[model samples]
Target: MNTLFTVSVRRISHVCTLKPYKETKWLMPYGNPTGIYVYNCVANQRVPVILSDPHIATWYSCGPTVYDSAHIGHASCYVKLDIIQRILKSFFNVNLVTAMGITDIDDKIIKRGLETNTHFTNIAKQYESEFWLDMNSLNIEKPLIITRVSEQIDCIASFVKKLIDSELAYVSKTGSVYFDTSKFPSYGKLSRMQDEGEPSDEEKKNKMDFAVWKGHKPGEPYWDVPWGSGRPGWHIECSAMVSKVFGSQLDFHAGGIDLRFPHHENEEAQSCAYHNSRQWANYWIHVGHLQVKGDTKMSKSLKNTISIPELLKTYSADTFRMACLTSNYRYSMEYTDAAMENAEEVLNKFKFFLKDAIVYINNNTATHPCQYKDSILKELQKVQDGNIEALKTDFDTATCINNMLNLISSTNKIIKNDSSGYYPVTVTLIVEYITGVLTKFGLKLQDGSQENIFSDMLIDTLVEFRHTVRLNALSKKDKELLNACDIVRDKMKSIKVQINDSNKTPSWVLIK
Candidate 1:
């Protein structure tokens, strides 16, 4: 819904007994009344998200055609959706089963194969492997099920045959099949596409009709289906794959906002015709485009695409992920060096605080907490709850991320002052909270071994300095120098470092 900030007066049925919703202001585009109101592109309104069973939800998302490298635009869609999926799981407790279709048999793949004098399947497989690698590199969670168009030819054929039998589709003279949009009364409801009276194609009865199966042509791969020896259409591939995976019903349908038009609309029509239901998917989700320098949408056709591998080469995964989170998912974001730099700064803030906090806990922790009471733990809990609220209202990551950062700032102040805070329990709990939020967004964290090495280096530096001071005091028998050694000893005691000074030379042992 990147192009959508349209107002709606219609109210949807979202009266789930499990949770109650409060009225919220729709002042901003992704504003509150945030009781899980998902933007529906079909209705052009923010419809309240409601599930029938509310226990398990079924979802399907469209995947790339896999003819070439997946770009940042593609990464933007999948990564943002993955964040929303995480929010749904953590905040709403919705156990979702998602499936994505891989378009391995497409015109682009065949054309590339022909140009390279290679087999189409080989071309498809090569890019398909690259697609998965890009997805893993971005840390996007793998879908529960994956369906490839090449492997699903028979199932797609069956779906098209059913539509033909119902008279909602027809077999063209060339043995190609097209959807008869004239027959389906609700043909343009999803996209609301008005007929501009464009001339009809030689093979189609109406200008609105689109191919469900393209008849085989010279130098093209084909399967011997009952209709013809050709592959499936791009739109029909999703409809058939969804039916094959989740049967007639689905809880959610997701894709990039660019797909809202003919792609998603066509899928809805064919699936509804196949299932004999008014609704093919209960909720529709679409993420915005990732543009370059705030220009037009990035695409291979425009030669404006930045590949995911190329971006990852320059910046960490957390950098890209943080950049995306800075803007809400439903709005198109500009990818600039400035934007990435800002994201890097934000990431380092939390990261440095976490690292320093952990080291402080390890080296300055006593057997008990601070002697005075502090309300830092309660403040951390409030941040966590505030994040939940932000996500509930359409996954507003901008607000949620700000909340986490604010808590980190305040906690850092308290820790720096050596204030009346419980370092043992409060600091430990703060670490857990920050770690959870970072992991939730798929941001990489320092590994356990790496943190241990860093801590050891700090201890080595401290022990070497203390040893130097101790030798001076023992050799000179200087009382003032000896008192400085006592100060170091008191500091070491807090970290369980025991020093013995009852000898010519003092020895210290680090407690495990």
Candidate 2:
């Protein structure tokens, strides 16, 4: 087996290994190269990504700053990334080790603390807690590692010192450190921006160069380092955390489109300069910005930002997730009431179809040597292959969803026109396929309600008792027993349970 070396900054320890890529059946031909191809921002073209190790893929996403409550714009980015990760796991059968860094000590955090008259550390903790709560409600998977800037201060300072020693960075008169962009010829390659024409602030020597460490301020939080008593810059925090957790290179780096310039560009330059590698991350994925209904961008300054909690009060998490998936990840999406309402309607239709399918399977018996069994099985296989192919091409979830809808339509038509009801195998296959896809998208048919084993046993007892009473009523022609059966039916109906009496063995289904 091949082995890859790992790098540590200062105090943190991380293990890294390089493994050979394993071929899989899902590989397809597209984007001028084979396998899964995604648009690389730096390459300015669609490039194929062949993982070094098929079993494990590394991913890093720029997490929230934790200074303020996360809004819908933030939700759009995280939800999209979550969906992409889900597809990579389920569709591609790859194990993902994802990391997201939290900016706990930042300029914004200090500003917010002064405004609220609270300690910056307290403010950061409070908002971080709130951010995790929102992520839980949205059903997002927690990252394998969450690195905080405050925790990685020592590592960050060590990284800056290495850059300065290599002549890639310089210390200013204020005892702060800044990266010398001129030293790194490919500094603007990721962002594709030219060098800055003029310096806006007189603090640094060049306009394009950015601060890796800031000087100590009177009231702001500071950490003791070789350079001075100041905190790490925003870009340096991410670079340090990535180096400590993922080592010199990552399989994928993702963030919103806004980070393409300045933030990500700077991160790429710094990491490459420190590691002496030409590339920092193999593939760069960015989700498009989210806009309000009036074509206005969602920003705190505009006072039009919608908080995640506020939106959750009006819409289900699944609904919001569906709305985000309907659009292409690379294209900007407009968040409107109508879009969410439409998504809710689509979700309801799926639930209704699944409910009916489940009821049909339970109520009817499987026919031996069924007529439509072969054809139905073949059709399901065809749909499954189509869905996988669509996903292989840049994760076109919209197309995958459309294919699901088409399958549902076809299933409905087949059931309506057939003289005989669906066979047991047919119903089982259709239900399993639909449910599997829904699970991949992080969706569920039921409205947060589940029947426990005890509840199931009780329902079975009631059904058996009702069946016995009905049989006795038939034998003796007793009116009281008939009334008791009707009462059971009424109660079941009130609880949204539908019972089928047409078959010899009664089976019930719960409708949402």
Name the candidate that leads on TM-score: 2
Which residue runs does candidate 1 get wrong by more than 4 Å?
1-35, 363-375, 419-422, 447-512
What tens digits encode model 1's per-residue C-alpha lDDT throughout 1-512?
53323444233323222110112111222112325777766556776665655656788999999889899999989999898888777667788898999999999999999999999889989998999999998889999999999999889999999999999999998888999877665666656775448647888888888899999898899888886688898999999999999997677889998898899879977887788755677678888888885668888999999989899888877788998888988889888888889999998888888787766656544433342124675687688788877776778888977988888887777667765444533554566667767777777765433542234444444455456666766889878766755755765664466766644444667775
Expressed as tens digits, the lDDT of each residue in 389-495 for candidate 2 is 77777888888777777777777665555565555435445766677787788764557675311235445544654565567677899886577567557656655
lDDT of each: 0.76, 0.76
| Root-mean-square deviation (CA) per prediction | 10.5, 10.8
TM-score against native, each model: 0.79, 0.80
Residue 91 displacement in candidate 1 (angstroms): 3.1
Count of clashes, each model: 1, 1
- Please give the distance, in angstroms, between residue 153's alpha carbon in candidate 2 and its true position after superposition: 0.4
